[model samples]
Each structure stands twice: as C-alpha cells, then as structure tokens.
Target chain A: MSVTAAFPSRARAWLRGLLAGPLALLTALLTMMGGALWLPEGAAGLDHLVVPVVFFPMLWAGWFLYACLDPRLLRGFAVVGGAALLQLGLILVHLMAAKGAVT
Target chain B: MIKLPKQQTQSLLAVHGWSGVLLGLLLYAVICTGVAAVFAKEISDWSSPLSRPSGQELPTGFDAAYRDLARQVDPLFLHEVFLFPTAGGRWNVLFHVDEKDAKGQPVERGTEFELDPKTLKPLARRDGLLDEIADQRRSNAVADFLVDLHVRLHLPNPWGLLLTGTLGLMMMVAAVSGLFLHRHLFKEIFTLRRRGGLLTARDVHVVAGAWNLPFAFLLAFTGSFFSFATTIGVPAMAMVAFNGDIEAATAALTAKKLPEDPSPVTPANLDALFADARQRGGARVGFVSLEHWGRADARATVQLEAREGGLLNTAYLYSLASGEFIREQPFLGHVPSTGNSLVLLMSPLHFGNFAGVVSKSVWFALGFAGAYVTLTGMLLWTRRRQEQRSWRIMDRAVHLVGYGLPLALAVAPYAYFLLRDRGPHPADTQGVLFLAVAATLIVCAAVADDLTRYRRRLLAATGVALAGLPLARLASGGIGWSAAWQQGLASLLAVELALFVAGALYLRLALRRSATDEATPAAGPAMQA
Candidate 1:
C-alpha cells in the first residue's frame, strides 16, 4: 500500500484510540457530575450525590465498551464527544447561574 | 451465550489477553491477600488475644471508663468521641475535635486510650492526631498489615488508591472480554480435560475462569467502587456540589444535623444506651459515636452488627442528654432511600461479613479461585511464547510472583508474633520481613535455571512458615488449644487448626509434585517453561 493510502487509516485508528481512552473517561466523570444536578435529592438530601458514586464503575464500563465496539469510528467519536460536551455545558451553566445569583 | 462478529470477537480476545497480561500479577496479589483479609478479625484475635475470651463488646462498666478518660482529655475534644472494640476486644476510646492542622489541612486531633476489657483500666494512652494513633497501634499489627496491603498495597493514599483502582478496571476488562471470547461458555464450565501439556492447562484455566466469571465481575466492580469512591468520585462530586469542600460534602452525606442547644447537661449513661440499641436493633453493638458530649444537643450513634438472618447493619441514634431513642439511622441519608440502600449493600457485598463465618468462607473460596485463574492465565500466556527470550524470562517472573507472594505473606506473621514485645513495632517488623522474603524470592528467580524447582521450594517454604506460626504465637504468650477450648476462644483454635491444615496440605502437594517430576523430567507445559 502507498503511504498516502495508509495515512487515512492510521488517522482513523488514532482517533478511535483517543475516543476509547481519554474521551471515554471524560464522559464518564461528566455524567457522574451531571447526575447530581438532574437527579432528585431524596429525603436525606444525598441521593444525587450517593447514587452516582455507587454506579460509577458501570457508567465507565458502558462508555468504554461503546467506544471500542462501535463499527463507525466517526459515529463513535460523535456520541462520546457529544456526551462530554453536553455535560460540560451543563456544569458550566450551573456554575455561572450560581455566581450570578451570588453577585 | 452472546454472539458477535468475527472481527469484534478478535478485538475482545486481544483486550482480554492484554488486560490480564498487563496487571494480572498485581490483581493476583490483591485477591490473594484479600482471601486472607476476609478473616482479619479472627486473625487479630488469634495473633494477640487476652488470657480469656472477651465477655461482651460493650461491658457494663464502659460508662465509668468513658467518664474517667473524658476527664483527662481537653474539653474541646468532647465535640466527638469514638468508642469501639479492636485488637482482640481491647476497648478503644478516642476523644477528638475536627480542626485544621498547622498546615491548614483538616484533621482530627485527639487523645486515645486502650482499656482492658475485663478490668476497664487503661493499658495504653496516646495524645496526638488520629492518623498518628493509628500508625502507632501495635496490637493488631498482623491483621492490619495484611488488610492494608490488600486495600492500598501500603503506598501513600490517593496514589495507591489510583493504582489499585486502575487494576480493578483492568480486572473488569478481562472478565467482561472473557465472557465474549468464550463461544461455548456453559460447556467450558464442565469441560476440564485430563490430557497432558499446554492443552490441559488451557482447559483448567477455561473451566475455572468460566465458573468464576460472575464472581470476578462482582468483586472487580465493588472493589473498583471502593478504591475510586474517595479518590475520584468524592473529589469530583465535591468540586461541583460543595465548591471543592470535601469535608463539607462528607458531612452533608453522612451526618444528620440537629438544632444546636449549648446548655450543659449531665450526660446519660452509655451502658443504658448500648443495651437499648442492642435490644432495639436486634444485634450486638459494634461501634458507638458521641457528638456534643455533656450538652443538651448531645447525640449518640450506635452502629450494630447485622440482625439475625439479615445482610446489612443497623445504626440507631439516641439523645445522649435525655437517653431517649431517636431513630434508626440509614447509611447515607436521614431516611431510608434508594441511595442509602445501595450504599449499605456495598459493604456486605464486598467484605462478605453479612452472614458471619459461613458467608466469609464462601467469599474466601471464590476469591482463591479468582486468584488461581489469574495466575494460570498468565502462565499459559507466557508459556505459549517461550521461544522469545523476553517471554521466557516473563515465565520465570510469573512463577516467581505467583508462588512467591503467598510465601512472603505466610512468613510475615512470624515477625509480628516474635517482635510484638521485645523488638521493633510488629507492624514495621512485618513489613521488613515481607520485603525480605520477596527479595529473596526475586534473587532465586533470577539465579535459578530450573523454574519448576524454584516453585516447589517456594511452596515448601510457605508450608513450613505457616505450620510454625502457632508455635511463634505460643512463645509470645498466646493461649494454647486446651485453654482456648475451656475459655471458649473458638477463633483462636479455629485459626490455629486452619493454618496447620493448610500448611500440611501445601507440603503434601509440594512433596508429591517433586516425586512425580523426578520420575518424568519433561512431563508438563509448566516444566517445559
């Protein structure tokens, strides 16, 4: 195979690797953070905090497996990247709103 | 059971093999130590017990002991006090106040006293930080040594937790991928072949791995949760929710706030509260915490062992000033909820202390099998590639660690027993001896040409060390079997017998293997390696 033909396949593999490794980790953590925001605070006022921690392993595994087994590399990147961005946006917005209220 | 395309299956196989090969030794170490750690309480009792068996965890005069100790401590430390039984039922009472250290770090500083269970008199006293108190403890050295290694590998916090957490994830990857890699999972569960060489080794690994899949997943999942909960989960949650105040986050999740009443009042008798908690919870009191001592808002939380035929422990709250029952406390929340229930399940599911000795025995056997699967998996991986020099050396290393770790663990307690009084602190001695044994094994692995002989020698040494432990204990003032039986010290007798039986079995296996291998020089794949 020519070098030009190999470059695209190599780039695709690297992107997939990035998605499966760091991006998957980022998504899992953000989901855990976002869970506390959206989930209900139960009678003890700690459900949101405790539930996400208990299921943290499963959350990470689900994201990691999806990143590895997805056939469409582009689709894999889109989903993981999308989840991370969404959670980050949610957290940032919540922080900004709290800061505004404090001011 | 689960079908996938050929390419995906190949990917799964690659993942499984790589994960196991990369972290299998550390994972094996953790699992092996954990098998022993399942009996940590019993081992502590066996290694360092009082002359007679303990009467009750919380005896009648516990109130007098508390009051006498409280008089010696600073009044500020009366903000919180923790009372529990440890180190063969020696009563430990800590009067502490949560405050910032000189370095501006949050810490609990306190005066701690260890009291004799029978006489209710102080055996030892220390005034300092809680962490320092823990580090200075010598009575439970052997059990603490083994439990610490399993929990954190004895490295510093956060980093040790991170490494073990990552290992837990690697274990989960191997377990999950193994599920996909085996096409005939149910068949393989009963398919151990008696044929010789690499094929037979492969069959044994598969059968053991197949039967232990669910257990491995459960252990790995729960183990990872524990390792990561404080390291990653707590920090991340605190950052978002409490503006990076980990202390505040922890307080919110754990403590139930009561309205402040600063008026001083005479504190109620702790013995009455203990008896009430035991009766109401239908279990023995295991631990007690007093908050705001001698004040109207004072409260006590008494954590009890699991009730009869139950899986989770129950803690009851009480008004310390009034001596009235407040409520049964949930693990995480003020009221029982889904989150609290899930958090409660984690301990019994991970430690297997829910149903007492029977449950612990089951967990120990399954954990032992998990360790076996990991060791065999590594051996088979390296054995297949022994043509390469690196892989051949790896085969030696696998044998070295796989067999050497148990040998080192077995030998560590001898230092604990011998050095408990005359020499250095037994905790430090245990660590030094453990490293010495490991280093010696490493040297042997490096110099020895015959891998099989090295393994057998390690096994024999382990057996001898184990069998001789009871003698060391006896020499260091441990009770003998007849006295133990008469005094109803079943834990001591049981542990002694178990160690002897296990040691004899190991010696028998080693002798039998030496004989069989001498007869046929190149009979098995392990010998070939």
Candidate 2:
C-alpha cells in the first residue's frame, strides 16, 4: 500500500497541472473568440462583437482549464513572477523619474 | 455511502484543478488592480506634484473653468463640465453628450485632459488621470493591459464584461471546486508550509483562496455583472419576468424616469444651483448635466449626484433658467436596484471605491494581499516542476507582473515629488508617473530572477521612499505638519499610514522568504537569483 502511494502518480499530477492557469487562458480566449463569432452581431463594429466573442468562451475555458492546469506550468509561475518584478522595478524608476512628479 | 472510483475522483479533481488554476491568477490581477484602483485618486493626489508640467499658472478656478466651457464648448455639449480641480491632483472635465436624437439615448462622455496648472490650457493626453499615469510608466499600460487581461482582456465591451463575468463564474466554480478538492479546507486555511512538491503549491493555493473567499466571491459576482447582466442577469430576468423589454424592465428596476418638458431657454443661475447642490449633496456633488446646452430652444440643466461613500448616488437636475431644483432622481443609496442601481453599485463594490480612507485602505491592503495570492499561486504551481520548456520565460513574466505593480505604485509618489519640484511649468503628473512605472516594470521584468527577492528589494525601497515622502511635503510648501496637525492630519495620516502599512507588508513577506526557502531548496537558490 505504501509502495503504491510512493509511485510517481505522474499521470494524475500532469493531468492536474493541465486544468490550471495558462491552459484556462487558452481555452477562455478561444471560447470568447469562438462564442463572439457565433453570437449574432449586436450592432456592428467590434464592441458589440467583443462581449460575446471574448467573455463566454473565456469563462467556459476557465472552467475547462481548471478541470484540466498542466501542473508543469504551475511550477514555473512564481519564478517567472520574480523575474518580471526585477524588470518592473527598473523600468518604474525610469518611468517615475521621466514623468516628473509621481504622486 | 457509495465511494466513486479513484479515476472518477481524479477526473473530478481535474475539473476543479483546471478551473481553479486560472482563477488564482485572474483573481489576483483583478484584486490587485482593483486594489490599486481604489487608491487611484489618492495616488494621483500624491503624485500630482510630479505631474506639475512646466508651467506657473494657477489652476483654473471652477467658475472660470466652468465659463471657459460656456464660451468655448458648443452649446450642445454644455450641460456642465465637472472639473476635478487641480489642487495637486488630475483635472477631469465631464459632461453628458447628446447622442442620437433628443428623445434619443443620451450619452455621457467623461473627457479628461491634463491641464497646464499655469495656463489652465488643456493638455492633450489619453487614459485620463490614473490611466495617464499608467500610460507613462508604460507600466500603466500593463495595468490597463492587466485590467483588460483581468476583465475580458480587452475583448470589447459587453462581451469583455461578460467574459469577466464568466471568469467570475469560474472563480465561483474554482471556489466551490476548490472546496470539494480540499479535504481539509478549514484545517489548511492558514497553513503555509513553504515546503516542496505539491504540498507547497497546495498550501499557497488553499490558504490564500480560503482567506479571500469573500473578496473573491464579491469580485466574481460584481465583475460578472458588467457583462453578466447583458449576457445573463438581464436576460435571465427578462426571460423569467419582464418579457424581454430590457429598457422597460430596467426602468421598473429603478424608479421611472420623468420626461422633463423641453424648455428652450438657457438658465441664468448655475452658481446658485451649484451652491445648493453642495449644500444638499454635501461635498461630493459629482454629476452636473445640462438638460439642453445649445439652441435658444435648449434649457441649461445641471445635475448633481453623490460620489461613493456619500449618502446618495442620486442626482437633482436644475434648469439654469429656473435655478430651483426641477426634480430629484432618487437612488436607493447603498440599496440595490435591479437596473441602474445595480450598475451604480457595481463600481463601488468591485473597485472598493465607495468608502472613506479607512475602508479604501482596508481594500487596498486586501488587494495587495490578493496580488500576493496570485504570485504565490504561480510560484507554487511552477515550483512543483523541476524543469520544463519556456519555464524561465513564464517565471520572468510572473515576477514582472507581481513585483511590477507595487514597484510602480510606490515609485509614483516619489516620482511626483521630484518632477513636481522640477521645471517651472508643472508637467502632467499622471503621465509622468505612468512613464516611470512602465519603464521600471520592463527593466525589472527583464532582469529579476527569484521574484521574491525582487519583491523584497522593491518593498524595502518603497518603505524608504515613503519615509521621505512626508518629509518632502514638509520641506516643500505643501500642507505641513502644522497645517495638518490642526485638521487632525486625518487625510495626510490616512494616506501615509496606508503607504507605510503597505511597505511593511511587503517587507514582512520578504522576510518570510527564508523560511519558505528552507522548504523548497530550489526556491532558496532561486531567491538569490
């Protein structure tokens, strides 16, 4: 029993990972685009198209992604977050200084 | 009790995982952005000094500013311009525009211009106020981008709102599914092992998620309303009860609209009405609309409504000719109305903009925490994996977004002080801040390794930067301690205290990194990076 518990369970873990984050993002974006395209035009131009096109699919996709996270992606999220921060801070000083009064 | 097969359980768990995973990121963005948005006005106020473009002209007085529009703007656009005033803050001029026909739907356009404080000449800039700041920081664009990212990610309007609503639904799904997946929701609420593998990620996800359930739920429900009503709420209501007459349905939801008579004569007494508006509505009489601005046939109308935290979202219309209140549009005031009232309520609750400093501060802190929750979620997710393709890129992005936001936020006020004091002509305060913040985010995004260390560095910097902020105010001719001391320093103290607290929180999080690193040795090494 203990040996069974110790086994990689990589399938479960990987499948679990797929259900979260970027996977959801992809699904939602697709859903929104697809749904928007499907819904009858509200008036014309993009704004009308936007609501149905982007939102529903995204919403549905989120659920789907949660249902699927691709766990590998989860592992990298924070590390990438840290890198993004460093870049953000450096640019902020420049932006803050360039803009004059920052209030 | 019948136990489902393990595979079925895993599938259900997968259902929860996927839906919940995206939620943590999106919700974090929304929460953080929403939090930052709460202090937007205050940040702008703080940063306005830097916004002083190169000019020496005193801010345009309300009367002159009002008269300028009276003379300059076409009569059609002249209901009245709501000047935000330039007392170390961005100037916003808003008036309702006549869209379509007279009996047609009236559209309100909030045209924000960064004015030369010296000349009172309008500055051509977009993204008005906070958005302007975002634009400059280029980081602001990221924020706007994040906002877009958060709510529909710039998918267009109602659909975007609907998308966010669906996201909100997913948030709800994640919340619910999360509960089901976690056998120990309450037990693990505050459990942060900072350990390795799935356990670490699990702790971060459950803890933050559990703690912020209220905020999370509110975010989803209110956010969804933006698109949800048009897509779901309104339609659902119509289908069930109103027979699909959305307009009629909306009218019934709020109070009925009185079709005022078309008086052609422009009003003579805007001053009296404005004074009365202040008296009746208290200080925050935000809305001023002209029933009709142009043509001898048009009557000048001024509509004054309450801002958030005040008594009413209701407005009263005064015909400039008849200065007396024509009639008041009564709002439920904190009470929810099915139609417009619901719309009115959404901004305050979602943005947490409805309260005084204390409430806003509470919201701001929560928002910051929410940002952390997202950062941790991503970190925990990624930490579980030893290696992968594009891991570094994704890791960098998270750091950029997470640390970028606060770094930009802290830098704004500092930038404001330096810039405000510079060049004779005050620069555009909002614009300057945005530019600085953006530049900072990009550079930080490019260089940072372990986002936590970056966060710590930024937090320490922010705390030091803020410590000097109050002193700078003293050195400059801003409201000093003597002046503030008399007024109880309520406003000043409130803002500073909030900033200080925010700095402290960041510092604390940074301090805790070591403990967390012990759990995940890879994380410890990454922290140095």
Candidate 3:
C-alpha cells in the first residue's frame, strides 16, 4: 500500500466510523418515529402504535449492527440515510394531511 | 459453529470490546442492583412486615374503606381513582384529576391514603401532586432505592432514563457481537482453564458471556423498551400523530370511551366485582381503577396477578353502575393482539416475576453472571492496557465501582432500618447514607496500596453490614425469628437467613483472599496486571 493510497483509505475509515456511530443513531430514532406513521395497524388497530413502541430497541440494534458490519462505507451510508429520508418523508406527509384536514 | 469472514469477525470483536470497555462499569452497577431488585417485593415485605401477614392483599371490607376514602377526597378530583397494594400488605388508594399546569403541561393532583390491609385502617395520608406523594412513600424505601438505582442510577428525569437505555443498547451490542466473535460457542461453554491468570479470567468471561448471551439480549431489549417507551416513544408518537396531545394519544391507544353522563349514581358492589374477577382470572386482584366514579358513565377495571404457571395476567372491565362484568381486556388496548402479547411479554422477561420465587431465583443467578461478565471484561481490558496511565486510572475505577457498589448497597438497608422511626424522611436519609458510603469507599479504593487490599476491606465491610441488618431490623421494631416462625412468616425468615449466610460467605472469602495474599507476596498488586 502506497502512502497516497493509504491516506484516502484512512479518511474513509474515519468517515465510516462517524457514520456508524452518531448518524446511525439518528437514523434509528427517525425510523422509529416514522414507522409509527407508516406501519400498518393490525386487526387490533394497535400495531401502528404498539409495534413501534415494543420493538424500538430491536430496530435500533439491527440498524447499529448493520452499520458497523457493512463492508462498503458508501453503501452503508446510502442505505441508512435513504431509509431515514424515506421515513422522514412519510412522517411529513402524514402531518401535512392531518393539518389539512383540520384546516 | 457459525462461520464468518475474518474481517467481519474482527469488526464485531472491536464493537464488542469497545462497547464493554466504555459502558461496562455502569452496566455492572445496573445488573448488580437488578439482581437484588428481582426480589424487590420480598425485600419490601421482609424489611417492613406488618403485625400479621394478611391472607389477601385486598380483604372483604375494602369496599367500605374505599367509600370512606371517597368521602374525604375532593369531588372535583374524582375523575379517576386507583387502588393497589403497596409494601407490607398496605392498600394504597389515589383519587386524582389530570389537568394542565400553568405551562400547558399535563399534571395530576391527588389525595393518597395508605391503609393497613388487615384492618383497613388508614396508616398514612398525603394530599398533593402525584409526584410529590410518590416521593414521600417510605414503607418500601429500601426496595425502591435498589430499583431506582437499577432503573436510572438515581439521575433525574428523561436524562437518567436515556442514559440507562443507552447502556441497555450497549449491552445488546456486546451480547450480539460476543455471540459472533466466539465462533466456538458450544466448546467454550465447557472450557475453563485451571491456570489462574489472564487466560483463566478470559476463559471465564467468554464462557459466562456466551452462556448469558441470549438472556442478556432479552434483558437488554426489554429493559431499553421499558426505559424508552414512556420517556421517548409515547411523546414522539404523540408529537407526530396527535399534535403533541399526550392525553389524547393515550386515550386513542387505549380505545376506551364513555359518554359524559354526570348524573350522580351510587357505584355498584365493588366486593362482588372483586370476587367475580378473582374467580374468573384465577388470580388475586392486583390493582383496581375506576373512572368517573360517581357518574352514570363509571367504568371499573380490575387487574389481576399472573395466574399460577402463567406469564401474563388478565384484566376485566365492569360497569360500576350495574356491577356487570363487561369483558376481559388486554393490557394495552380494548382487545388482544400480537402487539399486546409482545408488550405483555416484556415485563415477565425483564423482571422474571412470572413464576414467583423459582423464576426470581433463576433471574438473580443469571443477572449475577451478567454482572460478573461486565466487571471481568473491564478488568481484562484495562489489564491489557496497564502500561497506559489513563487505563491504569480506569483500572482503579473498575475496582472502586465493582467492590464499592456492593458495600454501599448492603449498607443502605441499615440506614433504612435505623432511620425509619427516628427521621422525618427516611428515604432521603437512606440516599445520603448511600452516597456517603460510596464516597468513603472511593477514597478507600484510592488510598489502599493495591486492588487486593481494597477488595478485601470492602468485602469485609459489606459482610459486616449485611450480617448486622437483621439485628438492626429487630431493634427497629421488627419481629424476631421466633415470632416470625410462630406466625408462619416463612418468606421473611428465609430472607433473614439468606442475608446471614451471604454475609458469612463473603467474610470467609475475604479472609481466604487475605491469607493467600500474605502467603504469596508476588500475588499482591502484581496479579492485577
């Protein structure tokens, strides 16, 4: 490994660590909140609320483990960030619809 | 063995070691306190026993007592009423109304009464905000102290809950990574080297960690769910779905609704309802809640204990006006669902109270092993880095918390017994004493020449404190062993005997360690590395 090549690799490693630690945490939290909006309510009409609340820990743990173990750093970032964005969009749409209904 | 790529295995190993190294001490504290807290109910009863053990938590005349308490509470605060059993077989009743505070935040103000279950006589009364009343309870001071330390480490509010929840997440990471890192799981479960050093210690940590991985994962998942559910989940859901109206979100989630019928109506026979609930559920009634108590829209919910050999309890709803059994209801919603079942499983899995003493004993042993894994992992990690100054400081801290925390916890019951009658706020006094002892131990840990001496002294102190707790209880108006036996207080007697035996065991261990230290000079502080 040449010095010039090693520098970029080290920088990428640092970026991966940052993404796996804090960004992963933020993504999990957003996903949980967004899941409450987007998830289907089961026959009892409580899956939307109860499922997210009960399995929040599992959701976070899964994300954390995946974030740390992914071999490609950019792919990990794209997946986590894209999931977070999707959830955020769902939540925003729901809130907008609710506000429109009220108005 | 489950095979994995080398690089992925190394990644998991780093995650495992770093997670344990970073949060290991706090996790150990939480697990150690949690082991004691698994028997929190029995501890409460043992520490603060009534004159005689009541046959049932709620006796026959509880209806009359409820009516009497109802008359004393303000009519404006009659929206909801709670009746439950507290420590020492005391019945606690709270009448409250939820209203917005000055800052548009929800708060509950109520009048609470603690009654002796045997006679239904009022033992203590408080009228104030619900949180204040909760802070003033003293009967279960010792158990509450242990539980609070486990739950939040006595830190305040959402921050404490968040910190503990993070610790739970870290524990989950450690357990999961440990499972993958140890490719020889089955083999390691039976592997223990007799050579006493880092290798032996490493083997023990791996074996215990591997054996406890599934349980640790379950505990971590459930514990974090509990910590975050109220602190973050509900509020965040409310923010998204209900426009931040927590009360509305709660009502919608519970699926309970009653039309506003303010006509004053006498409640139907509560004793009959209790009897029917007990017969139907085949369990003791643990809690009773009535909403709109004096109105035509009144509804009463009776929560029963877990039936024998069952993990979940059943709740029944009744019309307070007609005294008719409405239906059986799940805990979270109007009907049972997968979500409700999962939520129900969390409590038993985390607390290990599903099968009474047998389950609790199993939980205690497993939790102790979890604590051991945490402490040993930290000791091993720091021992490897003994050359680094920061790691050396951390080594001392590991010893301070590992040995010192148990001593402080053992001494708290003493403070509880000694100050119960002599002080105005025994709980607060107990907290101060707990901190004082911890501070003293920290100083001792720093001043002592080596880890061995510090550990020995702390263990000896813990042994003395634990052994003398029963005498302190006896001196502070508690019943003696003879009276306990005569009255069939077997649980209380067992607890006292267990404490004495544990104390003796700890003292013996400390003495043996001290003798070994004297015989082998090389085994003193050098062994820590």
- Where is model 2 more than 4 Å wrong at Cα? A1-103, B1-27, B49-76, B79-173, B183-205, B227-268, B271-283, B294-312, B324-326, B330-337, B387-393, B412-489, B504-513, B516-529
Give DockQ: model 2: 0.03
Worst 10 residues of 2 chain B by lDDT: B51-60
Better of 2 and 3 by TM-score: 3
Give all TM-scores, in the order shown.
0.95, 0.60, 0.95
**Residue-level lDDT tens digits of model 2 in B430-499:** 3467467768777875677665566567656666655666665556566655555564534455666666
Candidate 1: lDDT of B417? 82
> lDDT for every model?
0.86, 0.51, 0.85
Q: Which residue pairs come into collision in candidate 3?
A: none
- lDDT per residue as tens, model 3, B1-529: 9899998999998899899988889999999999999999899889988878865468887788889889998996779999988787888999999988999988999999999888898999999999999988888889999999999999998888998999999999999998888998999999977643434667878888888999999999999998999998888888887899887778887865556787889999888889999999999999999999989989899999999999998899999988998888787778778888988889999999999899999999999999988988888787777788788778888888987899989988888888887756777887898999988888876676677777777778889988989999999889988998898888889999999998998888678874544432212254332
lDDT for predicted candidate 1 compared with the true structure = 0.86
Docking class of 1: medium
Instruction: Give the distance in Å from residue A64's predicted Cα in candidate 3 to where it truly belongs.
Output: 1.3
Regions more than 4 Å wrong, model 1: A1-14, B196-199, B514-529
**TM per candidate, chain B:** 0.96, 0.65, 0.95
Residue lDDT tens for model 1, B1-529: 7899987887788778878998888999999998999999999888888877895478897898789889999999999999888877898988999899789988999999998898899989988889898877888899999999998999999888888887888888889989988989998888866544324667878888999999898888899899999999989999888878898898888878678999999999999999999888889888888999999999999999998789888999999999999998887767888888887888888889988899999999999999989988998788777788788778888888998999999999989887778767788899999999899899989887788778778888889989999999988788888888999998888999999999998888678874534332222344333
Error of 1 at A103 (Å): 1.5
TM-score of 3: 0.95
Question: Which run of 10 residues does model 1 chain A get worst, by summed lDDT?
Answer: A1-10
- Per-model DockQ: 0.71, 0.03, 0.71
